[model samples]
Target chain A: MYLLRRGDPTMFETFWRGPIGESATLVIPGYQTMSYFSDVGNLCWFLEPGFEREVRRLHSLVGNAAVEGYHVLVGTGSSQLFQAALYALALPTANAPVSVVSTTPFYSMYPPLTDFLNSGLYRWAGDANAFDGDDYIEVICSPNNPDGSIREAVLKSKSGKDIHDLAYYWPQYTPITHMLAHDIMLFTVSKCTGHAGTRIGWALVKDKEVAQKMSKFMEQSTIGVSKDAQLRAAKVLGAVTDGYEHQLAAAAGGDANLLFHYARRKMAHRWCALRAAVAASGIFSLPNEVAGFCTFTKDTVTSNPAFAWLRCEKQEVEDLESFLRENKIITRSGTKFGADQKVVRISMVDTDEAFGIFVNRLATIK
Target chain B: MYLLRRGDPTMFETFWRGPIGESATLVIPGYQTMSYFSDVGNLCWFLEPGFEREVRRLHSLVGNAAVEGYHVLVGTGSSQLFQAALYALALPTANAPVSVVSTTPFYSMYPPLTDFLNSGLYRWAGDANAFDGDDYIEVICSPNNPDGSIREAVLKSKSGKDIHDLAYYWPQYTPITHMLAHDIMLFTVSKCTGHAGTRIGWALVKDKEVAQKMSKFMEQSTIGVSKDAQLRAAKVLGAVTDGYEHQLAAAAGGDANLLFHYARRKMAHRWCALRAAVAASGIFSLPNEVAGFCTFTKDTVTSNPAFAWLRCEKQEVEDLESFLRENKIITRSGTKFGADQKVVRISMVDTDEAFGIFVNRLATIK
Candidate 1:
């Protein structure tokens, strides 16, 4: 008898739906009232009318060069658009062995989503070192998830056909225009607008057929992103662009300058704090800052943990996870991100206060 | 050369992303006032603590039922849940062939959604006039769309498997409990709480494996319905149920009595108007009144002779549709519904003023 299962019943179930019964609410220091839904919604509105208008205006401000066709189809959040693109392009045909190719240590969700969509029919070909055209479809996320490494332009696909997920190509990180030359460009309001809940994203595609197919797939898949979210996002995008323009107009000082100044100071403070904490413990080591995350390895002097710990083996990381969970501090293990058990990922997306709390907690780990 | 296509250039463009462009601003009447984002956000709260508290209170009021191992999974709208169930239950690998079986003259979206999901991979196995489980998945919608006929017991497979879609089983229509004894029970808030914009619906299944599979598919497909939408739906559901109970207490009447009273009164008014119109024409024939919609054939004669007094032929129905469009009225032609082209479906789901306008417009056809 085939007894049906209820829940995902897997170690990665949280990724499937997030901590089911836990309070994920957190209070950011400077940002008192942070609603992911509102932030994301504000970003969405710009994609509709306001953003489109701004893009046209930007073109005029820059030069007479036409904006690439691949830079248009924006969405509720990049996540929503990414899923739609997968459905639209990935057809489950015997002749067309649908395969997804992505560089290792990329955005964590890619492999799982690919697996879920595959339904055991297709699988992810995770070998960036030896990626080939036989993979059919390739997903590349620049300024990748954990390490935040941006692929240089020289690393183009051998077949010259690939879906470039430029999800993190904000002006602050990489030149946004540089990534627009790809056949598909994915951008999300979550990382840019700092609104993880609004769930809005977009894909700019040069191919009309691909765009139409993706749209159709989206319609069939989720029936489009929430209209309210999209409209709100458009509004936020307009406000941000306006702010950017005002900064540009200011003579000696502007919003852009102020933003850069603030970001630099904040990054320096956090980096120092992180460095001090790691050095004092002498148990964990981290590479230089990449994108929004810092990768860490365990120290050799420490007892070899079972899981992905600097000093411990793979099993120690799991034990450490249990220890952290008991203290209400949740950290993602490297295994979840398709990395060696010795490595763990920490997001720097949190505010100073939260980061401080996290740093302090880790400092006590020694 | 590979040409890149962008945007949807097809007739059945996906409608799941909420309305786009000018239509985005158009509020769906009665169902929801806030934009889709707000609705989704509100609905997502249901999955939160405060909202779950309310849900528990409501469950207590309704008495303890066996809800173990079954948790609610929401969708963009009931339309999405309907499609999800089809995807979950349909055999991925069938030997002879697999078909979707629905009663003739059922919810119109079923065939189209099935076709869209199938993408020419599978086809609907016409009405289950003969209950043969040799090659089909039987789909039955009680209190059906278009006709609104309530089926007491749907036809089951040879092995006793059944899929029941109870899209409309509110106190306003019929006293009904979801037929959970079946393999799957599909329900939606669009018809019940009237929150179409929330786009929240759920499927009740006895099989855990099926539920998990469907949930996994949905996570990758749409990444779980908008959290905001689910919470709002929970709020509406709680309030609506309370309102129904209060209304029932004030009237000192049971749900069936109230439902019968409203249904009979509305049916009488529409039937009277329709009968009078047909009597005056002396050449129109009407179907027996069983549900909210009725089919009528044109056979009237008039002296002005602009009356293209004709039989219900395929070409004539097409011509009538063009006529209606010209007058700024829209409707589903019989051809689209798999009905005889000579007969057109006239819906009573509109307001009285709209119905009056329709009557006046029909009078002009003479």
Candidate 2:
């Protein structure tokens, strides 16, 4: 039923719905790679140095984050990296399981992923403000997943290790206001290039041991990320950087920053349409957002986020997801995001047609 | 150095040296699938019933394993499946760590992977033969990684669960003497279709809860296997099965069993050459393998095996890998596989060019 309603304006697939086929499609050589090992900088499997070079080059150009003095470790996706970051930060050699915390309305994966292995190395201790702890892993999902809230580590523990998931910190998703130079920072092609199907993500780590351990975890798990995927990622990332140089003169009005500009405009347009829909419905409320000065754009820029965090306004109405589903609109319940049941998250990245249908249905939900 | 030696005659690189061009390549349709959460027959990610149908159909045509009364879960590779199997079999909820054991000269990954996370749920309990416990996971790697020996459960405890890794049970690597209907069976696209780089593998699991737990493990680790890879694997697997029906009748002398025939002959020829080389070396002893009744070929067929386990007969050649390295031939040491240092694993799957050089080097070693 879910598959049948894939684009029913009901399922808000937050992952990606971008250009594929020839543009993103990969035709791996018949005699292509198969080894879980690579000559990719003396690490574990699947990574090739050529591919890593391209990744490092892209980050350097984007200026969204610093890659220097960091071990570049790849994951099946940032979701895996999120788990790796926790695993690396919480040393088994430690006396007790490190407490993992984020502020309220955190990325849903954090708490569940932390406790999934049932491993005693780390425990999801809940809201950062409520938890009193020195040894903890503070996961900062800047330009956050569910609600599109930009945030800093709420916990002020000196002993806390911060894992900055910069998945949405790209110029297209959010303002590249600052160059992140955190201990452990994660970025993914899924959000940046909208190639979620590729399942390629990487982390830049300042600590050598933590980086090695993260890589070790990947090795024991999937051996490494897929080589075919890596090759595709390298190309896609190259194209993004190429867009920065306006390499495709025929596209984007010959603008140097084609990808970022196009994505930014598209996101902003979607946000406009979504806001108008919510306003017409008069049954939902949304939080206000502010833009930041972007280094890449050299201007104060704002982003219409990839998600619309919808909250029911009426006191009698709760179970926002169920409420929205009744109107043929699908959304993730706010409870999943550690918020109230009266709130739900509607994705802003679905196809234009689906988005139109969603806006129409949402407006009619009186 | 490893990348440079990719096509080196010393490296077998036999995993894949086949023709790869547009035909085998995949072009996922523009606006193709994304969303880590799939409606792929529930349970977990990367597994769509459409893809699972192809997998089961392939297995059925190959006469390799039983898929009935099983839950299909995909992973990054059989390596991940192996870890998942261990994790699923050893429930952390059981109040105590389950002893994970494999027989002597087991696949090198068993011990390290078992202990990687340092998870208290399971411990690497050395050799299976040495461990006497009911609650244990005994891994049986048929046509095992290091040495191509076919095997079964070394421990027969009532409370024990066995994970059968049939990675090399295909007719090309080993004779398909029987259809595996084990509790947990691990199979990979790498050895099967020589597409190891795709990082796709599946476990045919009999028990429902065990399969669900394994799916959960994959979910928390990589979220799921690469969907692109899964689609490609489905197509590649379909091609293999298509060859089984002689779908491309114009090729292979109208034989439906073209792939098997070609692969079998290639493996047999390689083995014949390998035998001659070892005989000429006069410093090594090779194990003798007999043919088994194969249902596919309808004959008592033998295998060339994917790996050559060579034992140094000379007293001076204690470190066989070092000795082979001195001769510009790279081989994995036997101690890595829990065997004597004098024994080393030589990959028999390298291309014809590399195999020839390896044969020449071994023949001249004395």
Best-fitting candidate, scored by TM-score: 2
Q: What is the number of backbone collisions in each predicted candidate, taken in the order shown?
A: 71, 8
- Residue A88's lDDT within candidate 2 is 82
TM-score of candidate 1 relative to the true fold: 0.65
Q: What are the per-residue Cα lDDT tens digits for candidate 1 across B163-256?
A: 6776554333433333234567676655543334334567656676777666655555554554444445455445534543566578664332
**Global CA lDDT of candidate 1, please?**
0.46
User: Which candidate has the top score in DockQ?
Assistant: 2
RMSD of 2: 4.1
lDDT of 1 by residue, A57-147 (tens): 4333322124554445555456657755765566645454356666666566777666542342335666455565543566777656655
